[model samples]
Target: MTTPQTPILEARALTRSFGNVRALDGADFDIYPGEVVALIGDNGAGKSTMVKALSGSLALDSGEILFNGSPVDLDSPTAAADLGIETVFQDLALAPHLNAAQNMFLGREKPAKGILGRLGFMDAPTMRKESQAALDMLGATVRSLTDPVGAMSGGQQQAIAIARAVAWAKGVVFLDEPTAALGVVQTRNVLDTIRRVADNGVAVVFISHSMPHVMEVADRVQVLRMGKRVATLEAKKTSMEELVGAMTGATVGATS
Candidate 1:
């Protein structure tokens, strides 16, 4: 088994509140480079809250976020992205009408040099090459880069989304419920792609409810319950029964 390395991202004593509800209560989490860490928990268990906080979509009332062992203030999603943190939420957030390359370079489109650059013309060839390279890195087998993403299968679209994150992410990539509504084949494909993403030396935080999926792909599993990080287990060394017990509080003293 491979040992865990130093964390590329860390959240210490993270706390947040939504009026009467305490969404996050001193939650702590971390992920290391070249590792796939699964963040699993029941609904309302602060999984989403933690992801949002890490991705900079939501600020914590109290906590410290660290990147590469140094403290960071992620005031917004843009701030996070500037620091090489990319998040792919459940929505996928792809431009349905656009092709794979177009969607990949949506807001961060490359501009052509010379006169075209001054005219704000996009560098289509460069974008296509980079987008294809990204997909290839993840072992994605999309039919055509020119085809609209909306026309692709769920698995294909998911590959594109993950590839986009992995392409631009210099530090950490967070994926929320990546295979939530995917079919068996699609889920399998996406899971394979996710592993490839990690193999490329990117720190991946995979959020999901699928036990088998997590077990297959993750190096470690972080269990959150009632807004607190209750346990951290090695995926290959831990059993599903033990994981379930930790999540449900059935095994109160369980630790890994």
Candidate 2:
């Protein structure tokens, strides 16, 4: 894939600290339009911290965030969402009792038209239709829209979470461990959905420790170690050994 000249989202010299631990020490990252960039590292290497900072769920001690080439302050998750940036955390965070459509429109439920709307009646049909459209767009399959998300398979639930994020996100979507704890088929389906999302022109920042999955789906791999970015390599050109070396600090250079 040919990389775009400018990034849709970028971080420069980001730093964050938690008491004695420096979670992010001068970290840098960038993702271009319609690209799937994987962020990988060992535990405590600041992968989570870097994601949190970029998603506007955590504030940094010092750094700069550029959206569409202009500096922007991501003070909260709402701020990030308003800017068309969405994150599907590892937890999935679905309402167990709620159906797929209901869960998708949990906090942003649409009201019915006329007096029923004023009386606090939700537009369930519209929400359900849109939810189906979103899932179809991402090539994600759910057994039924009315079925409770908790009753669905892990992969189905994951698809719903991702589709919800992609439905609202116009520029970038950050997915954390999206294919974790799944069967081989489920993992493959999720990865295919990820590629479809990028095909629709959304930049996907995939965070995963699974090297094989990363190599299969990512166009570029960004490695972080000791709270800083150590290497950025093209997935097609780099091997798993090189990625592991970068994560373990055995290699210390950016190939991309």
Candidate 3:
């Protein structure tokens, strides 16, 4: 029998509510290092809530979160970032006027040394070089780093976003509907970039509704139904029917 590895990121009994509605009810999730875990669910299944909670964008009323076996309080996005957790929301959140490199280092730009650093002068050359390296690491194809993101293609823009997350996250990166409106080729490129991220030893939590994308990119599938993780299935072993059943609660307690 294979021994299970300790999860790099884990959430247990994560509960949250809004007014009279409960968004999450005792949700549990865990992902091992260097693996891509896809989180899937139907509408209002609480997948978004869970992602927000994990990313420190939303607070849980009650629950426990552990990173690398140590308990943590993800009360803010900055707190999560400090702990090596990064998130790429569905919106991509890139600044239109900024170039790819500029967007990548928007808030975390490097400062020049000596008096210039004291004057808040950014080290543009170093930032550009590092940004280029980060994009190159993901094998992302782009015309120029100086070109504004708004001027780039959708695929190129998405690539930069994913690369930015990977460049900063030391433990886990959460991607929400990353390939939602992209073309086939663009989607493929993004998927390939995601795999490269996992290959680099950072755990990935992919939030998406596309079954084919999940099957193609994920090592495991996690089904969330009504704020609970109904089942966790090996991507290769479980069929789309099984995944759908779990999501719809038709096979909640059934073995895959």
TM-score of 1: 0.90
lDDT per residue as tens, model 1, 1-256: 3545557899999999999999999999988887899998999999999999999999899999998889999999999999899999888889999999999998899999999989999999999999999887766778799999999987788888988998898878998988876667667767887787778778889999889988999999999999999999988888889889989998742344
TM-score comparison, 2 vs 3, better candidate: 2
- Whole-model lDDT for model 2 versus the true structure? 0.90
Steric overlap count per candidate = 0, 0, 0
lDDT of 2 by residue, 1-256 (tens): 5677889999999999999999999999999989999999999999989989999999999999999999999999889988889999988889989999998898799999999999999999999999999888767789999989999988889889988988988899999998886667767777997898888888999999899999999999999889988899999988999999999988775745
lDDT of each: 0.88, 0.90, 0.87
TM-score of 2: 0.93
What residue runs in model 1 are displaced by over 4 Å at the alpha carbon?
1-5, 141-144, 147-153, 253-256
Superposition error at 33 for model 3 (Å):
1.1
True lDDT of residue 169, candidate 3: 91
Best-first order by TM-score:
2, 3, 1
Q: In terms of lDDT, which candidate is stronger, 2 or 3?
A: 2
Q: In candidate 3, what are the lDDT values of residues 37-135, reduced to their tens digit?
A: 999999999999999999999989999999888899999999999988999887788998998888999889899988999998988889889998987
Q: Report lDDT (Cα) of residue 11, candidate 2.
A: 97
**Candidates 1 and 3, the one with greater lDDT:** 1
Higher-ranked by TM-score: 1 or 3: 3
User: What TM-score, computed on C-alpha atoms, does each candidate reach?
Assistant: 0.90, 0.93, 0.91
Error in Å for residue 116 of model 1: 0.8
